[model samples]
Target chain A: MAGNTTPTDFGNPVINWIDKRLPVFTMMQKEYGVFPTPRNFNYLWNFGAIAMVMLMVMIASGLVLAMHYTADTKLSFNVVERIMRDVDYGWLVRYIHMNGASMFFIAVYVHIFRGLYYGSYKQPRELLWILGVLILLLMMATAFMGYVLPWGQMSFWGATVITNLFSAIPLIGDTIVTWLWGGFSVDNPTLTRFFALHFLLPFVILGVVFLHIAALHVSGSNNPLGIEPKSDKDTVPFSPYYTVKDLFGVCVFLIIYAAFVFYAPNYMGHPDNYTPANPMVTPPHIVPEWYFLPFYAILRSFTIDIVIPFTDIIIISSKLGGVLLMFGSIAMMFILPWLDTSPVRSARFRPLYQKFFWLHLAVCITLGFMGAKPPEGIYTVISQICTFLYFAHYLIVLPLLNKYEKPLPLPPSIHEAILAQKK
Target chain B: MGNPHSHGAQCSHDAPQKHGQEECPDNGHDESKRDFIFISAASMAAVGTGVVAWPFVATLGPAKDTLALSTTEIDLSPIQEGQAVTVMWRGKPVFIRRRTAQDIELARKVDGDATAFNSLRDKQKDTDRVKQSTFGGKEMPQWLVMVGVCTHLGCVPMGQKPTDMRGDFDGWFCPCHGSHYDSAGRIRKGPAPHNLAVPTYTFLSENRIRIG
Candidate 1:
């Protein structure tokens, strides 16, 4: 089996010597060089490689920013300013790291949507999907902690408000918040620890990314057609074929990222964050980074108290409900492989599922918009509705659709699909 | 043997397997176009990697210059009694107030009417708010020094200016979120979870203060 061993070349003395010991080169050759990939992958498939490249860009830029950044709350803002003005190309690095975070999310969201559309989480690939969700959670933590390192008004208050959410936990809530702060408030100790964790988390993400790819390679890749390669005719060597394709996709992604970094660097960032952290003044509107807007919107949606039916008891406060709902939205994604009960993997073949998939995308984007806006009259009403649909599409819609919807007949193989297209 | 490697026509059906190589169905698709795409792709990847690498190398320079500017000293003589002045110390606002006799009396008066919010947040009393008789320094009950930023979300309070409305307690009122501080810089009311933080400062010969 392709999964068992790499084809080793004993002809070269160095490769022959290494194969006997570690087999590193042989494994690379087998896994990446000539690995069999489905032939008919589309542009959406390119996002996985694009996400990987963006990760590289972020880490490279972040390492430099960390070297120059003073994690002390008193000096963090000043130190970052110095990096922009005094250090050579410090501005460029800071901008890229800042914008790269947005770009990373852009690619990741597309990558996730591609998975959802093609049913990449089905059957043998369930573990691969779980690994991807783990990466998303880690990425979120890394980004949140990284945002606090600047120690601007937004950074300081953002950390305080977000960490304060834990205080909603019943018995040990305040203690947990205190432990997280390492002091009475989000002060020097909090900054120091967040910096340490922020620096350390990317490497942990790198480890999980490795496991994600390993799980992917174990089951081979899902294709646009959402079918297995029945014969050699249905597949191509990964090298020179997908490598060139991925490289092209990565370059295109980089061009967009560079445009943001060089031109509109602060476009995605909040203007109030430029001011140094002052505990006395709060920005009139406190919204998180754009990447977190959707979740933020969901969190804000639960404005009214949930009264238990048949009783006048206000069992769950609106505050606690919002927290649970926000977390539950992300948690639903972790169990998606189970939640989506469709026999046919890809939405392309499933007519009823395909329409709801687009609805899901629209609901998410709407929630993000609502999150960015203050929960006023119309936005509040819309957010509650969108949050409902967002959960329903996954939980209620997908499971029910599995039994009722009739799928279109699939092509025999990837080779035949391409052949039919040519004629 | 010169043409030993020569295979059939370049199509999936014509040559499904040639030696150990598997032929993809789309092999006959434009070769020159693919070459052009690959070249552009390779160049862009190189540029992206190069752009991100420049910052990692430039930050190797020393960042020690900013570290030395952490501690600051302010002249208390210039700040008159019945007035508080905000000073920039280590990138944060430090509120220095030379308290009047009236102000001290108002803060010390027993308040059975309202809650002392600062006591719950900071666990310190009005007497403990000052550097009073601690570290053998001269007890200056008339002088009050605290970080000017509010305990809520880090906005400087409004009571520093005489024209500014000091919330009902006749002290600093945080206009940002309605956190009102007493004459002694203790939290009195509003959403602020604590009092204005008191930074570590000692009187330098009773006319100057050195703060870190």
Candidate 2:
């Protein structure tokens, strides 16, 4: 049976169709070189390729899930359960899709931090990095909206509370909330809109990713040295070099991803979500998804209540502070390329900067942890300190240290750096 | 630098074999090509193994028969008149409700002619007798049982009380999308396209009943 086909026969309809419609292999050869890529790319570079693979996996699994899914609010949850229990290979598809979301975020976080460490956002690559950040935001939104479609208790109340956050705005807040809900409350109209947006945003992220890649291609990848290739002699073909590396990385990633899907599918899920949505009984503590915990913490940190001058309206002081801090965190990243005055590029060459960067990362993670926990007295105090440090690292220390700290001598080449380190 | 192709050169070939070195041009090309072929073959094998293993890994849970039989029967004894109880059958929700006088009256008065029983009889003449055996011949149905899953999405439909606008439903209200079903679990209003399914069942006694 296998003898009928040659390696280049391309008898498979998919292979034949691809060959006819596009120059996939040729493009791979030309742009990547027949064996394209820098020979020395490290694990940090693996995430982008891993993310692409994850995107494909998520889309494939999600498509299968959508086939068995009922968009109607009443049956949506049950249909999801059916997909988990009844349809052929449905459980596999659902687990993959669900875990794929978590894996996507994991890869993306690592990808973003890799860019940060290598200063991939410097100079011409800033726009590419910014676009990547936008893609991250869009992804968060898509995941949030998709989570609500299950229509479980958490899905419903989470949607209701999150959508109601718009009411925190001034005069138009209530109107905006109503418009978002497509009704006076979170009902069928809200579910329909959430579904539509969830379906639509992935394509938006895809388009943004295209632009992100376009930007990356123009600048090329930043190496650990953060120096441009001096000549063709310095650069290697991308294909066999990076492709094999990326494939290995993907295999390792899949092992971890599979463990989560098979062993603890509900580890990241909220327990209250198992119950059906009951609008009358609010869940004791309303928390967003794990990914959104940091921001949720930031939103809850303020303790004051502010009354509009000469008006009866009163607003919680902490929520406003939290909102500002959240925006500040993201907005700070946009200005990072200009904020630091250090002559050095990579974090490896900047000892003080590296220390501060690690400290800031720790603070962000601590804030995220505190966000998920209830705001008791001690937790509140710790969150306040961490939140303060998170802002201080970006707003004050980074800029000031950039001027004062003396960076280490730069290596002319990665090869020289490695040799020097060995000696 | 040592000759690139010297049989025992100390300079490693792991580095990109530089040209204009002692190595023969043809030998360098052949070596690289061989490396490419080996790497490609290894990658293909790994990918093939992954693809084959995915299904088995995903299906590590119980077998089909075990999962099917995991469904447990629920008792409907405590369900008072005008009350409903939700039970699990085949991992999907099944609702059992006992109808009140007004519910039966409203169901009978629905199209002015009370011909639903006749229509049901006409549709399943052979199965009618067997199906009717459970309900018996009381003028009012003391109990109504159905899968709580919405025909549209499978949400558990809430039992609407007789007095509330939802209670006027005489059956159940699915809050997920506002689909309403009548006393007989027939889709009455909203987006549900099919009637709520009734599971295979046998009543053990008056109050105690078993559902499969």
Candidate 3:
């Protein structure tokens, strides 16, 4: 059967004939125009649309930046300078692209948090949430590789530090790192490969995003109340309602993005990255981009080796433990759908779950703050505590909360909830 | 409260009629005027976006200026025996060491099976570390040239400074991760996976060398 089964009746004779044969317009109308969405979605629900807009903005600006970028280690830093100083409007494109990465992450984080608050990851939507997590992983990889293209002090050293992380693996670790670098070190070949993959992976993300949306359409969208649409009265067509809301969201996001691109372009960037890479001089502190700080904190927290009881026989070295914990933080997220045993979908109805959610947010922010600080004196102890809280919130608290917590009574319907709110 | 639902239903009911009336001249004239404004505004935005996107596409091609500076030639005449001079080549540090007779003897006496930690990366013999034993038809065993980056993580070895300790192996030592190399630049201990890499180079003369 054809994918587009909607009626082909465009009023125009020629358009109607074409729709009967090809049906692209029909599919668009069915999928986007008349697609049913719950009416109660709030401003937080707009982040998914905002994220999609940011992705497009990033790709457009990234394409323009790529046209002028030179991936060679020696020339990359200079070419970026040339783009700023010499090329026509290259400064605007580069700034937009540079700032676009931060905006993209910001939008995606909000989108993910929205899903968490509404329990959009529950049962039927598990695959949708999993696809989203995959997109996040791809984004991290893309951002990491994209950072290296400028060949700045941070870019070069960051690649060396992150890629060298593979060496913490057993016997074949060094070999795997070498294979990734395509040589003994991160050189021109590594840059070339990263550039190729960076150029490639956004398209792969776009494909995954397509699947993500298709999956969203199948199950429909979850709302603030976390209740399914039981009747036509509970839902509205996406076009006029969601399309107008999404447009307004995109416009507001663009204003903030434009501010960053124009006024405080380098606010999110490190000053060290302006200098060309010198392998001899390591930066005073090697920190990743601000978005990765929470995980970076987790990596630096494991300064003590795990020894078996009283014996000196090391179960895991500090170095290896750091590597595992850093990766495990993300790996834990992939399993969160299974970890949360709650029958209730929305945190708004679950009072106990809501309290832990706020605490979890605090732990994450604290971890991010600690990540940026030097791992010394009081900072290390705080980081260790925050890291413990982050894991415990997901692994222990979420499972336990699901079993014990009782949820508030739900409204009979969306209309009833709206009427109650009016009182 | 009921007005919103009624408004939505009215629009859905009007949708088929609106599609059917595309070519009709009897439709509201003000609606056509608003449609014209929307079309022009949208077209202008599209054009503006395209204009803004052009420079990024224009500047992405390969650069020719820096590629020309990839090779470097260093003079070895000023370098004394047991001294290593670092030269910049392709934006990396390359070490050119003029070995003393004592250094050469110590390097040659190093046992293959006992000292070499990871010899599999560069299988060349200690004698082969130098480009040619005889350059200009004379013995030139005192010179050893290598890219200065450590095999582990690209840090320059510390023993380039005379005051710096050469580790337990009595040669170049990388303080960053404790990788030690013998006088022949062979990896002998610590975390380095292989020897200091030998770059492609040629002796322009007895005292001159070109490295790419």
List of chain A TM-scores, every candidate: 0.96, 0.90, 0.97
What value does the lDDT take at residue A3 in candidate 3?
68
lDDT per residue for candidate 3 within B1-212, as digits (tens), equals 12334334433323426545344332355456557889999999999999999765433332354356667888899998778888877656788888889888787775455544223233457787887646768878788889887766556786776887786667788754456788888876654656888899888888998897
Ranking by TM-score: 3, 1, 2
Residues B87-193, candidate 2, lDDT per residue (tens digit)?
65544455677777776666656444545443321122212212345444432255666666554333456663444335235666665435567666666655444
Model 3, position B92: C-alpha lDDT score: 65
Q: Report lDDT (Cα) of residue A1, candidate 2.
A: 16
Candidate numbers, best DockQ first, in rank order: 3, 1, 2
In model 3 chain B, the worst 10-residue window by lDDT is B1-10
Question: What DockQ does predicted model 1 obtain?
Answer: 0.04
Q: How would you encode candidate 2's per-residue C-alpha lDDT over A1-423 as one tens digit per residue?
A: 123322343457787567455646444445565433444578989999889888888777877777777767788888888888899988888878877898998899889888777788888777887898899888988998999888888888778656755665656865676567654446666777688778788889889988997777777778887776665555677766776788999999999999999998788778887787655434546667787887766655654445587653555433345556676778777777777656677898888888888887888788889887765567777877887887787779978987899888887776666667789
When summed lDDT is taken over every stretch of 10 residues in candidate 2 chain A, the lowest stretch is A1-10
Please state the error at residue B206 of candidate 1 in Å: 27
**Tens-digit lDDT track of model 1 for A1-423:** 335665577699977887767777778788899899999999999999998888888899999988898889789999999999999999999999999999999999999999999999999999999999999999999999999988888898788778877765656976676667765457776788889889999999999999999999999999988989999999999998999999999888888888998989999999888999876555657779999999988876776555687554556655567778989999998999998877688888999889999999999999999888855668888989999999898789988887788899998888998999899
Write one digit per residue (lDDT tens) for candidate 3, span A94-115.
9998889999999998898888
TM-score of chain A, cand. 2: 0.90
Worst 10 residues of 1 chain A by lDDT: A310-319
